[model samples]
Target chain A: MTARDQVPDGAATVWQRAVRARERADREEQLADKHEAIATETRTELHFRMAYIHRTTAARHRVTADLLEAHAVRTAEWTRRGGPPPLFMTGVAEACDTASVAVTLIDADSNQLAAAASDEPARHAQDLEYALGEGPARDAVAALVPVAASGTALRARWPGYGPAIESLGIGRVVAVPLQVPGDCVGALAVFDPRSATTDITRFVWVADALTRSFILGRDAGDGLLGEIDHRPEVHQAAGMVSVQMGCHVSDALELVKARAFADSRTVGEVARDIVAGLLKLG
Target chain B: MTLQEQELAAVFAQLTGEAARDPLDTQALLAALVESSRRLFGARGAIVQYTPGGAAAIQTDGTDGALQALAADAVGWREGPGHDARTTGCALIDVDVATHPTQVRWPRWSPRVLALGHGRVTALPLFSKDGPAGSLVLFTAPGSLLDERALKLSRSLADIAGHTLSLQREVSESRVLAGQLEHALSSRVVVEQAKGILAARHELTLEAAFARLRRYARSRQRKVADVAREVIEGRIELPTD
Candidate 1:
């Protein structure tokens, strides 16, 4: 079969998005050049700042295009091989020189609204953070800065989460806040990354790219390439618990998390039981 | 830098610095633009007719009240060099208001403009990526024309203002889109939570709970998310059975 015919429909669509992103990046670059020309001619600081803004925007679009293209190629290969579907975060993790990465979208209060992970360990690590109510991702988002912990410091920083994630064989972690102009929307967490990969600047660029192009820009309608997991079951369980115990939904959410931690199970497992009417909590 | 270059630099800095302070205040930016144009070009008056994304605004600056008033009214009449330049996306260079062709072209506008003590009009188009954004009109004394150098300076000023306004519009649009996305996500979460609450309270399936929630919201002419929030908060309990 021809390469075009061999590619899956989803991969084809992703490839098309990649092409569009590249075109937009080129346009942004041209705009930056025009602004730079004006700045040079007029010798004004304002035009120079405008040029910088356009250059930064162009860089973000370029990164997004690269990521989308990588995802499309991986997906096409996976379709041919037929095992598990390729994840969008896998390319992100590779960019950071790690095997595991997780992106967590948060509400204004720094509560995680959704999450996507590159692999099972990263997924488990995210769940541990949700159940324990603390982790690098949460800290990075709350403080609006990068958070890093390794070895003993990990356990020292997060008594509950560090020990739990360490048990899953992850020793080092780093996370950066994904910020827009006036808001911090999410965090990107790297698990068991190499020491060389701890360059915070690289992580920041990836976080910004994900926030601008994937989460909140024109491509946001695709829901981060359909990789984001909003964990509806957890919220639903919180609702059921709230009605059963005559408490607020937020309080019920905490109760559900507490139950999951106490039972040594993932939040998703406990939430599924609660939603299925097989479990109840006060 | 030459004296002229230094003055040009200061004007650009001032225009952009003020805009940076309050990017959303398009009126303030337009007013500053016209005032700067009037002073820089040594015109009797300057008028800017800006319509960015359908929100039209007319700003005028001059020592003569009659000429400024006429400039504002000319936008409504669609009869000045500003209107022509805006519609055609081309600059009008030193058109004598008393000329026969100018009078015949704008019969009502040319005579009133002449009576206001202005004899020459020059208009530069403000262009954006989308198309013609607006035009900048400069009125001068009889027999006084803007030289080639002044016309070039006017075009640059108008171009920069147009680019800034376009950037402002893009930022505003993105902000709106981001807000809507956040709202939609939060609303969906609330709706899901409300479904679970109703399901447990009435021993109904989640689907049935959602149906009841929608029914109550539609009946009251309210948003489902609002009704759902109330349900989750225990403020408004839907009827059972």
Candidate 2:
């Protein structure tokens, strides 16, 4: 594993900050329309709230920064010894106090739009759900709560998804909905979490922070392409396959996903081939 | 609804409307609070003293120049019903100022307050979850005190003021956080653009490009953003691995 595959804290923070800026700009515009005295009072309250949010956000960032810095130090030492260091998302998984974690962003239809995982197994788990379209994430979104299942319960509830996940050696799973108001953008899925009870709370907080402060705020303006790993090529390939197979784009996408699952390859790889004209769907 | 209930509901709706319009406008909320307190209690005048960014006071109409001066002096001296309410985080009343025992407590402040021709004063603490935000003070006519109904109404208005301040504070904080987020986003965007350029130029994956950029930044004791900027500007080059 190489360090390149990690979504750095710097990038996440930047994206979060941008979303916050847009919110502030809207508030500032509203403030301008108010009376002078009201504006003055509003300004003070705004400062107070800003201080509170800054303190909380900074505290959270400090912990992540320390963790990332320590990993960087270890990587540097290893590099000096001529060895490649571990990937970055592994730190995110560890930060959540879990061995494997996958953050998936879905659209209104609960279809997986993008996903990032701590490791290959975690990625496979997400892919399995994405292909089958049923799992903890879907259930979490449906219920708007944290969904946890271990061992028999996991398999029993999910049926196909459960058996497949167990095959990946993930006996326990936790999924927390990332939602704000009426909108639910995605779920954070943790596999084989260290402590289900405590990790659930952490996952809930992470999900809430991501939904309230980062994702939903951006998604309000269709500003999600920056952080999500959007597969435009896949969409293009789906469109092409739809024309060739005399099917709808949705059906074409399903066919592509089914083929990828059957071949035991990543959807990205198969989509690339389709787009490159090396493979065609009939 | 009874006439009283209908009147109260209308007042509440108006306050809520003001809040919805500009929830962070503390001064307007305070002004409205003082006016409501004065109108509900039929007091000689109403003053709201709060430590927003700093100590401040706003008073409803009908207060003479002398009374306004006394209210300002009370805050300045830090020895009045408003000051006490803020310090104790409790409602305070100095009824019948001429003979009230607490009148002795404000040695310098009470005399001026009484000289303003106000007989009684009440201060209700405005609280935030963290601590006391400030106090709402009301002045009744000389030799008179707010009746049970009037006091209750005043308390209700003060509570609304507290809610307004709290709501405004939240809105203000969110805006500031958003501003900081914008700065962070722009810097990250530059770094990301640099990564894309490097990845395409070297026929490397995005991840490999990021690793190289970060590694170079660490070696030079610089931010990855700085290194990425240099790369994008073609001032620095990364050897293909």
Candidate 3:
């Protein structure tokens, strides 16, 4: 397919916008440095502080711009390769030196409300966690730290989850919690990473970059929110189950997870069935 | 607490809060500094003279025509307790304006202090990190020296003002940087979109299309982003060279 046919106008526009932003940010940052040098020469706190602020703001812009450039490059390359549809999470996967990774955003109760994965296997891995309600992403969020488990250790820590995930031929996994001041938003999960040394710091960096430059940045305006796998169907299924079983929404969600786990089906699949009136629970 | 004391507490709280935040609003903070110091010490009025900019902002508790004239005179004459303190990096107190040594030192402006019906004037240096950035002057009734407590409090307020001013400058500079980034990013997006359009239409590679876009932009002496916007909107076309 041609580049335009392969890449949607909106997607192209987003990446291009990001590139221009980065360029401008770089210029502004240099200007700030010049001012800072002058302030340093005079040794005035007020002038130095002003210059410092400008530099910091410019740095923020630079970061956003860098992210957009990466995104645009990834999109163009994917279009050229005639690959499967592009997802922003693909960038995180590439950054982590892995082909399979997922970025998941959790709600207040630590439920995965939105997710974007690099590939189907990665998506399935995350879906399994959401269905089982026990996984690296959930644990990382709960502990507010990075969690890495490979092979047998993964199964030992999460008896059901470890065995289920192993069935997917994933030998190792690592997750890092994404955090902002006073809030742990979610976690980034890397599965079967190509890099042998499980550098938890690398995972942390990806999470930080995503949280600051993409999720919280201006690029994540109204349009990008839709890109997140919001999984409204799951919430709808939970609502239906709640009404039928006379349980709280939370309990209904648990039931949905349990049914998915029992059937060895993805929570999304089970949720979809319930939403489609093909499944019942009491 | 008494009304005046309560007001002073609120003002200090606001100033302290602003200083702690990322962006310090210098103008608003300075105004508050004068207002709080004027009320706390019961001064007729207060004036802040910025060191670097030589700008003076005045805040008065009530209609004090004398204080206004005195502030104007200090700025115009470039001499007085405020100017002296800023220069010396030390506080200046003229308790008795009539026969004070300041009259001799500031022959032109010192006598005017007495004429303004000011019993006492105190100038506190607004010390920045390196040195005095400006001066905060308080005008009080004649024969009424700021008590030890009031003197200490006013000095602390001046210190706060200096810090706040620095922070405010930082915040404004950062905001300008953010605006620049947003503008650049939006422009870039337009350029990238145009490249995609070119690549798709001509069956050319993305790189080739971008190079063409750049080539066209350079030839026309225009921004690549502006050219890209034209291409995307079909307002212009690149030469097939």
Best by TM-score: 1
Native interface contact recovery, model 2: 0.00
Location of the lowest summed lDDT over 10 successive residues in candidate 2 chain A: A218-227
lDDT of 3 by residue, A166-216 (tens): 999899999998775445667889999897895776577567656655665
Estimate the lDDT of model 3: 0.68
* Per-residue C-alpha lDDT of model 2 across residues A117-231, encoded as one tens digit per residue: 7788888898888777789988998898999999899878998789988988998998998764345667889888776566466666556555544443433222222334455
Candidate 1: give the clashing pairs.
Answer: none
Say which prediction, candidate 1 or candidate 2, comes out ahead on TM-score: 1
Question: Residue A266 deviation, candidate 1, in Å?
Answer: 2.4
Please, what is the TM-score per model?
A: 0.83, 0.50, 0.51
Mind giving the per-residue lDDT tens digits that candidate 1 earns over B1-241? 5454455557677666655554467777777788787777778788877777465565443335675676678777988788888878988888888989999999888989888788999988887657887888898999985666666666767877777767666555556666675677678789889998999989998889999999999999999999999988778989874
Tell me the TM-score of model 3.
Answer: 0.51
Candidate ordering by lDDT (highest first): 1, 3, 2
* For model 3 chain A, the run of ten residues with the poorest summed lDDT: A1-10
Chain A accuracy of model 1 expressed as TM-score: 0.85
Listed models, DockQ each: 0.48, 0.03, 0.03
lDDT of 2 by residue, B1-241 (tens): 4333344445555565565564345656666666666767778777767664443443322244665566677767888778788778899764566775766788887787677777788888886535677787788877674477667556655654665666565455554544444344434544655555555456565667789888888888999977866765557886665
Candidate 2: segments with Cα more than 4 A from true spot: A1-88, A196-199, A212-227, B1-241
First chain of candidate 2, TM-score: 0.67
* Best candidate according to DockQ: 1
